[model samples]
Target: MTLKEIVDKLGATVGLGADKLDREEEYCFASDLMSDVLTLKDTPVLVTGLCNVQTIRTCDMANLEVVIFVRGKRPTEDMVELADENDMILICTPYSMFKTCGILYGAGMKPLY
Candidate 1:
């Protein structure tokens, strides 16, 4: 599914990279553990509740293109700048991590496993 669709489904706000909302994403992995994030092979779209600069850094390192911040958490300005610099997309939703994952999964987003 497209990032646009995911955002719509999750009622998320685009904190950055709004122009790239049409980007297609077939897989996703939700986790708060940065170490686990690094272990993924494809680095699928990251659905995380960890809203920090390090989250952006980890995704950049892993080549994950998108991050969905759950529970309405917003990234700091520093995090936004870093993600923008890396051309990464950041999305925020008011739902819990579990709901975020479920909505995305129900929308046909595949899991890494």
Candidate 2:
């Protein structure tokens, strides 16, 4: 599905603009463990509750295109800058990790299993 669709479906607030949010992401992986995230294959969209700079770094390392920070967590300015520099999209949602995953999954975002 498209990133815009995912944002709308999940009621997420995107931090980036049209240039960044206008992309398609088919796979999604939800986790707080950066090490586990490093094991992923393609650049799947990520749903993470870890509100740290490393979260964004991990996404960069994995070539992830988007990151949804669950539970109302927002990334630091440094993280945002790095994400922008890396051409990554950042989204924030008030939903918990479980609800975030459920909402995206229900919207047809395949799990990165």
Best by lDDT: 1
Task: Supply the global lDDT for candidate 1.
Answer: 0.92
Across residues 49-109, which tens digit of lDDT does each residue of candidate 1 receive?
A: 8998899999989998799999999999999999988999999999999999998888799
Q: Write the per-residue lDDT of candidate 2 for residues 54-95, one digit (tens) a residue.
A: 988888888887889999998888988988898888899889
Q: How close is candidate 2 to the true structure, as a TM-score?
A: 0.93
Candidate 1: 10-residue stretch with minimal lDDT: 38-47
Q: All models: lDDT?
A: 0.92, 0.85
- TM-score per prediction, in order, is 0.97, 0.93
Q: What's each prediction's clash count?
A: 0, 0
